[model samples]
Target chain A: MTVQTWTYILVGITFALYIGIAIWSRAGSTKEFYVAGGGVSPLANGMATAADWMSAASFISMAGIIAFAGYDGSVYLMGWTGGYVLLALLLAPYLRKFGKFTVPDFIGDRYYSKTARIVAVFCALIVSFTYVAGQMRGVGLVFSRFLEVDINTGVIIGMIIVLFYAVLGGMKGITYTQVAQYCVLIFAFMVPAIFISIQMTGNPIPQLGMGSTLNDGSGMYLLDKLDGLSTELGFNEYTDGSKSVTDVFMITLALMVGTAGLPHVIVRFFTVKRVKDARKSAGWALLLIAILYTTAPAVSVFARTNMINTVSDQEYASMPAWFKTWEKTKLITFEDKNGDGKIQYVADAKQNELTVDNDIMVLANPEIANLPSWVIALVAAGALAAALSTAAGLLLVISASVSHDLIKKVFKPDISEKGELLAARLSAVVAVVIAGYFGINPPGFVAAVVALAFGLAAASFFPAIVLGIFYKKMNKEGAIAGMVIGISLMIFYMLKFKFGIFDGGKSAVAGLQKDWWFGISPEGFGSIAMLVNFVVSIVILQFTPAPPEDVQEIVEDIRIPSGAGQAVDH
Target chain B: MSDKQKKASAYWRENVRYLFLLLSIWFAVSYGAGILFKEALDTIQIGGFKLGFWFAQQGAIYVFVILIFVYVRLMNKLDKKYGYNE
Candidate 1:
């Protein structure tokens, strides 16, 4: 059967399964909507959390990005995973002990101030929207490539699917659906990787295969061969990094902090039954995530080597069928520069006639190696599962923040549970539409926007939540001031450096990197902003009176893990 | 302070100590070996992998998973020791 037929069968079955789960798990009350009735088992929550955490960026773009960045990509490998350490140790259990439905609930209640909650709500929205936009775009990309649908149409289909599960079943439906998604995505990612690993190095394990000798009878290590091939094509050795050590350090720190702070990820802990479960679930989530994370770099190496060998300096007419298929999608193009039909996949921009989108490396890997059509089709289903699961999680966060934090908590404190549930569903629909618009007309590359989301979360949420939990003296005045300053500084730096808004717009962004603050890129500037938040909060706290005695008591209460009741609504 | 309060504080202190120790290991592996000392460690290779590169891309991740599980065990034991276990 053709790849498209297999894709239709697989994608259709997965979507049907997700919808079935949503129908079966329809949330009946606000508790179910927000925290899945606060009774999710640790193992199930762990699977759901893993699916929620690994977005399109991790599933689709990361390996491709790493292939191009080479050793410099270690920032993502270390930065993204290491954050789970922060989440598991510093945040998850305590937050679970606090027993809240949303991040703003802790901030508002702990600080004993409405302003602090509002600031948290604002940051949550910004962070979630940026992150979700990337997920929607990922959905659109998969649909457009595999199903031959327009990107906008794909986004609309995605929005409808997410809206169905999210509005109907809320966290309950999303949780069970995500468990299914985790299975689909992990299975899909590993099958091709293992296939390619065995084919390339005669080893079944991708992680070990990456270090083993090539199977071509050359008796050369895979990395050694890749490095040799890379330099021969005027590229840096694949094992060496070109980014400055300081930048890599700061960027890694920012991503780690940000991952710990992301509202959607942190909120997943609220669904579990106990503080101990929260801690255990974080372990399971990271372990599940590591299965894919550890294998990504190895896949990048395999795909990069395969791509360079197949297309570099090869005649365009003899290019494989997958090349032609991808070419029609406009993701891979060859201009036949120098009046020759040979493809020049080179380091120099002026002479390089082929432009391949980073996404193609993973999406086309199975086809490049002549893997069966079913395997290729499975990747499509997996990418959709990944993109949709994360999109639903972020959408839930956005909707919950608006419905629970703003409307229910602040604007209409007397709103009914039924009214609040309605508001949540309505907010989700609006959020999905906005997200689909961004997907159809993306602001930038999916990964870059997602990285900035992490930076935003790191800058604003991490410090406030940490201080709120760890320090009984963390007053509302201090927390509010710190969050405002930290988020504002991060936004200013991102606009100036990432978008070049201050220097005349997107065109100036290229030249603005040289003027980065202290040589820190906008992506890494979160660490600096987070530092400022900690300092500003501490300084402000010295002048302000300590938090009221009751608030301090609440802090002491959360520190103990024995009696973490169901996530409280009021 | 009451006996309960004292016990809670003791548990908190122990948790902080564990966090400090485990996080130090986390930092040493990822930030230390993976980035700062990567070049120096690249001089040494394991199998077909450079030590630093392996840490950056592979080794650090394995260690992170282990560290979290370690923290989970320590925290659970501390809860039981302090009579906070459910």
Candidate 2:
């Protein structure tokens, strides 16, 4: 069978498995819909969280970013993975103890203010939407490549699939489906890496293969060759740090706090039955996620080395079939800079002008390594799994924010349970549609928007949740003001850098850019926003009265693991 | 021993301090030694690998996994001492 046909068959089988899991695990009540009845095993929750956490960006774009960015890409590695540590240490157990269906619910009750709930809802929507759009685009890209459909049609199909499962199963369905996705994605990612590693280094383990000597015995390590190739092509050596120290520090901090703050990730903790279960699940989830995170840098190094050795200094017409295929997809393009038919991939920045999209690196890695067509098809399936799993998780959060937090809590407290469930499903459909639209016409790269989503979440929701759990004195005014300032500053900073809207004209900030405070990129500014929120909350609380005495008792109760008789009905 | 007195606070404190020390090492390897001070460490090579490069791409992640397992073992011991064993 042709590679395209094999890809279609494998992908179709994976889709059937996911839909089947969702159908089997369909939620029966509002409680099940929101928190999967708080009965998920830590092991199962770990798998689901891994699938949800490793989105299209991790599966498809991360290796590409690492391949091209060289040492600079460590920001993503450290930032993304380190966030889990923060989540485990600082956020997950307390949030699980709070035992609410959604993040907005926790903020609303903790702050004891309707306005605080609304502010939380706004932040959740912005963060979830920003993140979901990237997932949709990932699904569309995979569909376009493997299924031979236009990107728009692929996005629409993805929307339909997500809507069917997410609306039908809610958290219960999404959780089980995400587990299946984790299996498919991880298996697919590893197969190609293993094959390429053995082919290049005779090492069966990709992680070890990265540091092992090459097969040719050129008296040089694999990394040494990569460093030489990259520097020769105007890229920094793979191991050398080129970014300003402050930028790396800020970005890593931002990602760590942002990961800890993301509503979708935190909500997963709530699905567990006990605080200890939540903690165990966090550890397991990090383990599963680390498997991919650790392998990505190896993949990046291998792909970069292979690309330069194969393509640089070769005639344009002699480029491999994989190059031609990727070029046809508009993912890999050559401008013929200096009108040289002989492509020069060299250390001169001017000559290294081959415009390669970062998203295509992992997607094209199998082709680059001359792996079997089945492995290529598996990668396409894995990318879809990563994107679709995350999209469902984010969509669920959006729906819950609207139906549970907004309509049920603020607008119509008297709504029936059944009515609320229907509302949640309807809102989920709306969110999917909006996300699908953005996917078809993506405003930016998957990583950038994802970073912005993290920034917004970190700024607004993380501080409030953390303070509410750890500090008893934090009151309504403090929580509300902290979220407001945190979210506003984040938005203002993002807009200033991303669009240059406040600098009077696009050209004004183009040459003389000064938006970032002390050389911090907008992506890394979330840590600052989070700190601002924390400081503001503490300062404001000193002036305002403490939370009611009953609130302090509730705080004490949440800190302990036991004596919570039953789940409180919000 | 009294119920509260049976649990040695020193054991928990020592374990937590160890976890902190290990985690600090992890942070230094990835963020400090690997990213910030990479150029300074580039002058040194270990086993044909640049010292800083090895830390950034490989060393820190390995340490993080090790730290987690170490913490888990310590926590189990702490739970036993506190009579909160699961």
Candidate 3:
């Protein structure tokens, strides 16, 4: 069969599996809908959490980014994984002990104010929506390239598929489906990696191969050769640091804090039965995540080396079929700026007329390597699985925030369970549709805002949740004020430098290019914003009324592991 | 305070201590070797890769996975000691 036929078969089988799981695990009550009835085993929950957290960003784009950025890419590798440490140690167990379905539930009840819950609900919606928009766009991007569907039509199809399962099974459906997705995606990712690793370095393990000698008779080390090639092309050393030390420090910190505080991931811990399971589940999630996270760098190195060898100094007419195919797709382009027939991939923009989008590095790697048609098909399915799994998780967070947190808890306390569940499902439909629309006609700066979603969460939620768990004296006023100040600062900085809003919307300035505060970009500013949040909360708490006695009692209870009462169905 | 409260407090204190120990290792491997002292560490080589690069992209992640399991074990034992184990 042809490659397109294989792609259809693979994606079809996976979607069918997800829909089947959704039907079997259809949520019976709000408990099942929200937290899978709090019965998921640690291992399965771990797999689901890994799938929910990885997203299309990690699956499709991370290796591509790493391929070009070289050692500077370590920030993503460390930041994304290291956050689980903070989650497992500082946050997850306590949140599970709190026995709640959503992050907003914790803030609302713990702060003992409907106003606080409302504030948290707003934050959750904003963070989740920003994140889901990226996932929807990812789905559209994959479908358009492989399935021959228009980006908008692909988004509508994705929305319909998600609406069917998510509206029916809610968190339960999403969880089981994610577990299946994790398996498919990891397998798909590893197959091509193993083939390439062996082909290049005579080692099947990509991680070791990354640090191993090349199979080529030159006896040169892989990284050493990559470094030599990079310098020859006017690029920074592939294995040495290029980014500012301070910026790397801050970006990694921001991503870590943001990962811990994301509502979708934190809510995964709510599915397990006991506090100990929350701790164990975190370990499971990280281990599963590490499988892909570690392999990504190896993939990066492989793609980089392969690409440099294939195109650099090679005649544009004699370039490989993959090159021509990608060129047709406009993912890879060559302009003989110097009137040389040979395509030169170099760091100098004037002579370097070969433009390759970083995102294509991962997607096109299989084709570039001449891998079988089945392997390419598997990758298409894996990308879809990654996008869909994350979109489903994010939509649930939006649904729960609107129906359970805002509408039921804050606005109408008298709503029946049946009414609330219907509300949750209905809101999920609306949320998925809205996310789909944004995926098609992605709003101006949606990509920019997506970058800041982590910053916003890191700035806003991480400190609030951490303090609520650890600080007994944290009053509602301090939490609310800190969240506001934290998120606002992040947005203001992103606009000022990234979009040039502060400079009359020129979007570029002569002298203002490198004029960042302490050399910190908007991506790195979250760690600073988070620190400010902590300080603001503490200083304000000194004068504010202390948390109520019952709130302190609840905090004390969450601190212990013994009586993690079964998650309440409500 | 009750005797049980004292025991629970001690357990909590021990848990925090273990976290401190493990997280210190975490910081040393990633932020320390991967960034601050990367140049110093790069003078050393592992297989074909620079030691610092290995730590950044590979070693730190391995250590993080190990650290979580260690924390899990410590917390579980602490829970059992304080009569908080399920």
Candidate 4:
């Protein structure tokens, strides 16, 4: 069968499975909608959280990013996975013991101020929305690129599928759906990686294969060959680091704290049955996520090596079929500026005539390796699964924040459960539409915006949540002041550097070195802002009145596992 | 403070100390071996790759998974010790 035909069959089966799960496990109450009735087993919840966390960025774009960036890409590898360690250790179980439906529920109650809740709600919306828009675009881009459909049609179809599950079963439906998605995406991701790994390296395991010699017995190591190829082509050594050590450190820090702080991921812990289950489930989630995170670097190496061996310095007249196909999509362009018959891939942009989009490396890798057509189709299904699963999770967070946190908890405390559920679904529809709009007509910032979401979460929510958990003295005034200052500084810095605002094309500022503060870009500035948050909160706590006795009691309460309440009982 | 509160505080202190111990390992592997000392570590090869590059991209992730499980085991023991087990 044609690759397109196979994609339809595989993707159709997965879509039907998700809708089936949604209808079968439809949420019956606000409790179910918000936290899957808190009945999910730790292992199941772990899979769901794993699916929710590994978005299109992780599945489709990460290896491509790593392929180009070399060792610098390790920032993403360590930053993302390491953050789970922080989450599992510092936050997850305590939050589960705290027994909350949403992140704001903890923040608002911990600070003992409705104003604090409002501030948290504001942050949640900002983080979720900014993050969701990118997921929506990923959904649309995958559909249009692979399914032979227009971008808008792809986004609307995506919205409908998400609306069905998210609006119907809420977290309950999304949970089971994500479990299925985790299976599909992981299976799909590993197959091609395994094939490519075997094709190049003698080993079957991609991890060991990355550090193994070539299958053809070239006598040279894979990394050694790649380094030689990279330098021959006038590029940095593939094994050598790319970014400055300091920038890599800061970026990794931002991603770590940011992942821990993300509302969508944090909310997943609230699904499992017990405090112990929460801890176990976080471990499970990381083990599951590591399956992909570890495989990604290996895939990056394979794809990079394959491209160089197949394309570079080869005659343009004999350009491969996959290269021609991608060139038609404008993702790969060959200028042949030197008019040399041979294609040259090099570091110098002008000197190198062939420019291939990094995003295409993973999607094109299977084809480049002359793999079977079905593997190509399987990749499409995997990309869709990754994009849709994360989109569904993010949409639920947005919906719950609206219906539960803002409307039911704050504005209309008297609203009925039925009314709140209806509001949640309605808000989800609105959110999907707004997200779809952004996906269809994405701003210039859409690409970098997910990283911005991380920065925002790192600067604002991580400090607030961590302090609220550990520090008994964390009061409303201090929490509020910290969030306001931390988030404001991050926004201002992002505006100054990323969007090129504030300074209006002016050269450099007081604390900045070459338009960057300490050579840290907006993406890495979150770690610094989080530091400022800790310092500011501590300073303010010295002046503000201590939290009430009960608030202190809550801190001590979450510190243990007893009296965690009937978290799994219906 | 009451007797139970005092015990809980001690348990909490031990828990915090354990967290520091684990996090220190986490920091050392990712930030230390991965980034700062990556060049020096690169001089040493592990199989086909540099030790530092391996830590940055693959080794650290593997360690992260291990650490989380270790924390889970330690905390469960702590929970039992504190009579906080479910």
Candidate 4 lDDT over residue span A1-570, tens digit each:
888889899989999999999999999988899899987999999999999999989998999999999998998999999999999999999999988789999898899988889989899999988888888877887787778798889888988898889989999999999999999999999999999899898688999999999988677899999999999998999988667888999999999999999999999999887899999999999999999999999999999999988888899889778888788778899887888788888898878888888778889999999999899999989988999999999999999899988998899999998899899989988998898899888886887778888889999999998999888888889999999999999998887887766655434434454768898978899999999998899999999899999999989988977777644322
In candidate 3 the C-alpha lDDT for residue A117 amounts to 87
Residue pairs of candidate 2 with colliding backbone atoms: A232-A346, A232-A347, A233-A346, A234-A347
TM-score for each candidate, following the candidate numbering: 0.99, 0.94, 0.98, 0.98
- Encode model 1's per-residue lDDT on A1-570: one tens digit a residue: 999999999999999999999999999999999999999999999999999999888999899989988999999999899999999998999999999899999999999999999999999999999899989988999999999998899999999999999999999999999999999999999999999999999999999999999999999999999999889888899999888899999999999999999999999999999999999999999999999999999999999999999999898889999999999999998898797889888888899898889888889999998999999999999999999999999999999999999999999999999999999999999999999999988966556767888889999999998998888899999999999999999999998998888899889999998999899999899999999999999999999999999999999999999889898767
| Alpha carbon lDDT at A466, candidate 1 | 91
Poorly placed runs, candidate 3 (over 4 Å): A509-511
lDDT of 2 by residue, A1-570 (tens): 778998989989998998898899888888889888888999999999999899999999989988888778888887777777667756776677778789888888888889999999999998999899989988988999888899899999899999989999999999999999999999999999999999888888888888888988775789888877777666677776667888888887788778888989989988988766777888789889889988998899889889888888889999888888778889888867888788876656677657678988898889989888999999999999999999999999999999999999999999999999999999998999899889888865445667678788889988898788767788999999999999899888877876567776545655434646887888888889989999998899889988998887677556554433324566
Clashes of 4: 0
Strongest candidate by lDDT: 1
- Among all windows of ten consecutive residues in candidate 1 chain A, which has the lowest summed lDDT? A443-452
DockQ (0 to 1) for model 3? 0.88
Per-model TM-score of chain A alone?
A: 0.99, 0.97, 0.98, 0.97
**Which docking band does candidate 1 fall into?**
high
What is model 3's native contact fraction?
A: 0.86
| Angstrom error at residue A534, model 1 | 0.6
Tens digit of per-residue lDDT, candidate 1, span B1-86: 99989888888899999989999999999999999999999999999999999999999999999999998898888888888899
Q: After superposition, how far is residue A250 of candidate 3 from its true place, in Å?
A: 0.4
TM-score of 4: 0.98
Fnat measured on candidate 4 = 0.95
Cα-based lDDT for every prediction: 0.94, 0.83, 0.90, 0.90
